[model samples]
Target: MDKLRQKDYFLFASAMYSQPISCSSLVEQATSPFVSFHQRLGCFHSDWHQHEWGQLIYAEKGCIHVNSRTKQILIPSGYGVWIPPDTDHEIRSTSSQTNIRSICFPVADNNGSLRQTISVFPMSTLLREMIRYTNRWNQGPVDEAQATTFLQTVQGLLPEEIDKAVIVYLPSTTHAKLLPITTYIQTHLARPINVQWLASEFGLSVRTLSRLFRQQLGTSFSGYCKIARIMRALELIELGCDNVSQVATDVGYESLATFSNNFLAICGHRPLQFIHSKRLY
Candidate 1:
């Protein structure tokens, strides 16, 4: 393995968007397997992008918001996000402090037969440390063999299934009006949002928008919005926002009491209880 220069790294990262999709350098790095770790503090924006290779993104200290088409997933620590090749995605830091480590590797083929969406799974402490270690050792041959072994071990230990609560799919749609509405809901999750306002904004009748939600997303508009709120609440709580009431209000619930009730219904626990249980784990 050879340490990549700064220019080499940037050029490699850019290949994810280039045509005739290539990942040779990334594969060599993963096979020779020099891992590079990065940490970004404060809010940052990545424009809509696609990669020719698959990426594993883990939040080491805070939370990240990933928007891929109409579906959005909030990734907290102890969880890693998997993005398949060529899937357009963008990420943002939602917490005051956020740290993310990513490993990019080329897929063996571009068949598109397997899953082509984001997957979130639990990461053990050991796996986290191994990733960091691999990043530290990404260089010449002296550390190459050990790094390769560690990479294999980490990949082997990765969870095969995603948490049901952590996966959301954005259904592809052709309806022109629905795109802006979906994007608006995701960006303004903290604001009080209602169907009538959404309907009016898109020049859609409330009945029309409601039907569209069912037809395209396979869920009621309110149900989908609640799921979105739950995702936001999860991110806020993970960032040490201990005020459950404030978190609830921030996610657009009218009352803390109502938020608690709804959170229990969807997540099988109240907000505080979920946080407590996760801490124990």
Candidate 2:
């Protein structure tokens, strides 16, 4: 947290965004209670801040990670975070070319049903298209009638609760020794991962290393490695690295069939299907 930067206000659009519809236009849009920021971000993050408006911070390309003190939400491409008004959180981009679509709505637009905590929602074919359509809608100020219709459509499409978003419960501890090990697994996904091999390389007995993973992370070393590989693959895919065979090799699977099987098991979509279905460009 100490290493991160925070902005006083995240609701306003940054210069990085180049939407045909200017941010100012939306701010003054008639009865519309929402305004949005669409931009491609470099390697930067905002300080913890909250506003009277609830928000949805998303990445059209790459991944966006949102964290509160107790929880961390990974907004992998195709996923979005529904942050309630005034919820304290910090945001950072995992990639240099992270394209963000952040929307803010006054609390009144929540309809008294918005969840108090951060939650993930789906962008179905209809929902996804609506988002794009709305972002492009700049025909003068929106009236109360139009705003109500727009808001109703959005709320109807949103899920009642968080579904399958990748959320990890973070330990308050820095987990110094364990952190580097995970980083290695992510970076070296193309290589085989063996707990004994890692333990030996890191100068820890296999048993001690095993215990550390189980006790601190509540997951076995191999389990953690498996997830690390998949998460990395997801990132690469969202970043436009779409060749399944290439992705399989990059993520350490020698067999393409094996890779697809694991991908289906974890992501519920075959590698190629997932790649095509994503909103990535």
Candidate 3:
């Protein structure tokens, strides 16, 4: 449970793995299952790389975009992404001054929420405090006696109870027919979303597209489109784009009242309140 020096993590992958195709061997014998670090994200980037240790990444500020072979996920504040050991992944920040805190754990699944692949966890108040506390402890001096107790208590714990922590899940799917339509919908959210119109444009019958949505995503076309618009609207607000009315119009809502209602329903916060609340957090 000893804290690592700056150079330790620089050679983290190399020290833990000689083969990029790492296994659980290194993690099995780790003295400490956790290592925490704070990093500021800018345009700085890394090539797709991996470690033998599983990682849980928390964005304390702004947004983190992660890309791997099967999943490209966004980790917003108050959310954590659990990346399994030996998985190929890359990370980027949408904002220049974004702050990220990551905890790397040994590769083990001991009846917990950690998955063999990437999983998103919602951060609870306690989990958030634990993260900050651990980081502060690591950065300050260490007491040999307390370090062992701290490590034992915190290392394998999940951020929150799985059900309680769950939030927006934007699944990136590979279904052939659904892929193009979903992409088109997300891209063209500024325009009205009409399933029949899409069916005409994509050369599929409206019934066929509706069936595809049911089979693949388990949601109606209108349901999915509304969520997409709300997501985009949130992004616009986060980017400081405009007032609520302007954002509503920008995302193709005919009226601010309609936009506010949908935004509240989907996000659990009014548009302006959400923006102000995010700044407070």
Model-by-model lDDT, in order? Answer: 0.65, 0.64, 0.64
**For model 1, where is the 10-residue window of minimal lDDT?**
2-11
State the local distance difference test value for candidate 2.
Answer: 0.64
Give the better candidate number (2 or 3) by lDDT: 3
* Between candidates 1 and 3, the TM-score winner: 3
Output the worst ten-in-a-row residue range by lDDT, candidate 2: 2-11
For model 2, how does the per-residue alpha-carbon lDDT over 1-281 read when each residue is reduced to its tens digit? 11001110111223243123233344345245676566676545666666666776656766776777655556666667788777777777646567777767665554666656777543455555556666654445557567657766676555443455443223222578777787677557778888889989888899998998888877788766666667667766755677888778777888999888777766667889888877443
Question: 22 in model 3: Cα distance from truth in Å?
Answer: 14
TM-score against native, each model: 0.69, 0.69, 0.71
RMSD of each: 9.7, 8.1, 10.0
Error of 2 at 30 (Å): 14
Ranking by TM-score: 3, 1, 2
Task: List ranges where model 3 is wrong by over 4 Å.
Answer: 1-32, 43-54, 66-72, 82-90, 107-110, 116-122, 136-162
